[model samples]
Target: MSGAPIWIGAAHCVSALGEGPRFHLQRMRDGGTALRTVPGLTAKPMFAGLIPDELLPAGPRRIQRLLDRCLLELLDDLKPRPHERWLLVVATTKGDIAAMEQGDAAASALPLLGEHARQRCGFGAQPLVVSLACASGTAAFILACSAIEQDRYDHAIVIGADALSRFVLEGFASLYALDAVPCRPFDAHRAGTTLGEACAAVAISRDRDRIPEVIGRWVAGSIAHDANHISGPSRTGEGLLRAVQNALRIADLRASDIAAVNAHGTGTAYNDAMESIAFERCGLSDAPLSGYKGWFGHTLGAAGLLETIVAVQALREGTVLRTLGLSEPGVPGRVNAISADAAVPGRMLLKTSSGFGGCNAAVIIEAES
Candidate 1:
């Protein structure tokens, strides 16, 4: 089968920093951080980009309304061809689960999401929901590319969103993985991850060499599982390294060609160490690497896509923000986090993510030609 070029036409995101691309890019450039404390959770402080309660709509209908607003922004940015087949792919580990916890009536069924997609975006194609834990966002992007390659769709809308829910909060609390304060990824004093809520949408198409020639090429990507544990990562970083190797090999590139890495550094002990090892195995230990979760909190399902958006921006802008809470190097031999005024040009952006159920994924994006 012939491969197709997936062009990221436009991207829109809402996070702790702000809403939309302009807001987020400004925050990144200014080195501004939005990590703060939330009250009434537990004695320990929890730092997250908790969307203001007021900003979050009251019920399921309201949540869908919020999603529609973001979708409209994406559509406004890129008005795709009317005759082209458009596929809608929504990624979230807990879709409307926050509403369900509040006893909202319409948050239970998955199909309700498709209805929202259809109503809001006018995407007549069937909606697909991917709930593959943290990798959901990146996985959704890969799936959309596959669909286009197979001639199933000319354009695809990939959106990832999740709201902080009691279920999620309590579950992470049980694992004692919820940091009371902003997470310190790869920091010697790192504690745990802080959960954040966010929504991000990207428009991808098969048309290549177009106006916005895909700045980043999704040459190859893979999703693999450790099948070893549900919560913790594989001790050897086997799964992660395998995915990286596969991506690099498929792209006909070597680890030496990678300029930097956007890691899935959740600020947890095990994850940081494993990721470090994976990078080392892939011969990327010396590469400049960073993580955004400390700034945006772990947006769960949205983390991958939102982070990828930032990676694309890094490619276009030639700079990456430092890991917000990272300092003192928790993982040995792992390069220090980029904190300020570092410029990397002519390099490929390698992004990696791991989630519950041992799900892991990695993708490589190059600068726009």
Candidate 2:
């Protein structure tokens, strides 16, 4: 496996925008947003993104359904492939959060969700659940890639899903982290983040010749923590900065190699400012920087994987996705934040995520060679 090449064999997503990668990608190309004033879920009408009732069934099993749709698709793409030695990594901030609100703590336990995925998907593999707040998806992805590269598994599947729930919504509200309108990442007038629900899946395999769906190579990944605060990111962006540097080092690439920076821009004041500082420190101040929160809102645990898929597509197209809803560059640093879609014309992408408990992660994806 040391000489083997790892590839993202397949990937897909389900969210407020729609199902499959086409809808999401088309919506992004058109600069359309799925965010709206979602009502009836909270006391007041809150600005957030919710899977339309027609698109996603309403019930306690929505999470399971998401796993079903996302997992089954990737698994289908992996036909004729053995899975007895494959790895399944589920990433979520809160699994079956609705169960907790309904006074079923045991059902809400993360491992139970993992077991459900294994049983529901009928895979021969047990599940490993990664729950590192908003960074869970990326962390899980990093692990899966590393495992396959180390010959620990024949292949790896990374699934990230987090449904919207009152418990989670109110928790963010308590911290005054919900924005009054759709989020505007890196914008001066940005207030806070708007939450969204989504499930995203990616498959990684060493068999490149047989897998044309392989979008790109997972060049490198790293995780770091600043120990700054539980919810707030480091004011100095220390953790995120370090993670990016480590990833670049591992890939043996310089900052100039990154075509675009697919950032975890949650639209929060502190997060955006911190990322601005981090990119500047990496000498990426002139890079085309973009965020996806405005297009899909903050999809929590699903964010990293979902955004990574988009970044891969962006890298192949040699263009940077727009930072939707961003009118003015603000963040207290001189960063080249994209206000509109622009040509980057490069083969590499730098995707970074930051989450609660001072956790941060980075992954560098390169166009399939």
Candidate 3:
């Protein structure tokens, strides 16, 4: 399986925007967002991106509910034939943290969360959970690609989810990272990120011919760490630059081949500036760029997969989405942040994410040309 191309058989994301990828895409096309004022885990009301009340599960196990809804829909929508060897990889930042706050002894553990998802989805084995902050979802893709290259499984399902919990909301508030209103990524007046929650998944396989549909081929990806700070990004954007450069080397592509860039734009002052410096250093300043944080806030663990699904759809549709909250470019570098949905002449997409602890990841996906 070394030279085999990993095919994305199916993709689905459940966010405040909608239940499926196409539905979410349509909502974006309509220029609508799910951001609104919601009661926080604390006493104050905070702006958040939440799944519609009508779509939420009625029972307990809040985090499990999101994963179950996503997987069940993927199973029904894709209808992939039963494969004997299938691997399940779950990406999450804080799993069942709310339960932990309520004194559930093992609720916050990764293994427990993985086991619950495995049982609900009826997978052959327990899931391998990735918890690398915001990079967890893209990191899962990197793992799946490697596993397929090593012939470890016939197919892999990577699901990323994080629900709005008391612990997480209060934690961000403590850091003073919340913006009072909707966040404006890459804007001159940008302040901070609005925390978001979502569950998203993609099915990939080495056997291209067996896939029900091919959204795109996973060409290459890489992750790097700058170790600059425990929670802050490198001032020079070193980690992201190396990650993008390494990914291009693996994919046999240059910066000019990329048609559009789906950035990890968290709308933070430092994070946005870091990305601007990175793209300029990597010679991608001219590439159209936008952040999805404005659309669904920062979905923490789900950001990578959630943004990838949206970017893939944009590539297929021959368009690039506007950075929702962008007004004037604030970064020092020549970052080409889009103000409206624009057309792209090429199908190649470079999607990147950065997270706490100086972690960075990037992946290249292209339309089936």
Cα lDDT tens digits for candidate 2, 189-224: 999999999999988878775454778988999999
Each model's total of backbone clashes: 4, 0, 0
Tens-digit lDDT track of model 3 for 1-369: 578778985787888877877888888889666888887556798888988766766567778888887888777755544556778888999988877888985767877877876776678666799999999999988888778878888788889999987688778888888888788888898888998889999888887766566788888999999878988899899999999999999889999999999999988888999999999999999999988888888998889999998888878889998999887889876789997999999999999999999999999998664
Candidate 2: give the clashing pairs.
none
Candidate 1: count the clashes: 4
The predictions' CA RMSDs to the true structure, in order, are: 2.5, 1.6, 1.5
lDDT agreement with native, every candidate? 0.77, 0.86, 0.86
* lDDT of residue 357 for candidate 3: 94
What ranking emerges by lDDT with the best candidate at the front? 2, 3, 1
The C-alpha TM-scores of every prediction are: 0.92, 0.96, 0.96
| TM-score (C-alpha) between model 2 and the true structure | 0.96
lDDT of 1 by residue, 105-207 (tens): 5766666776777667776777988888988888888888778777888778889888766677778888989776788888888888888888888887776
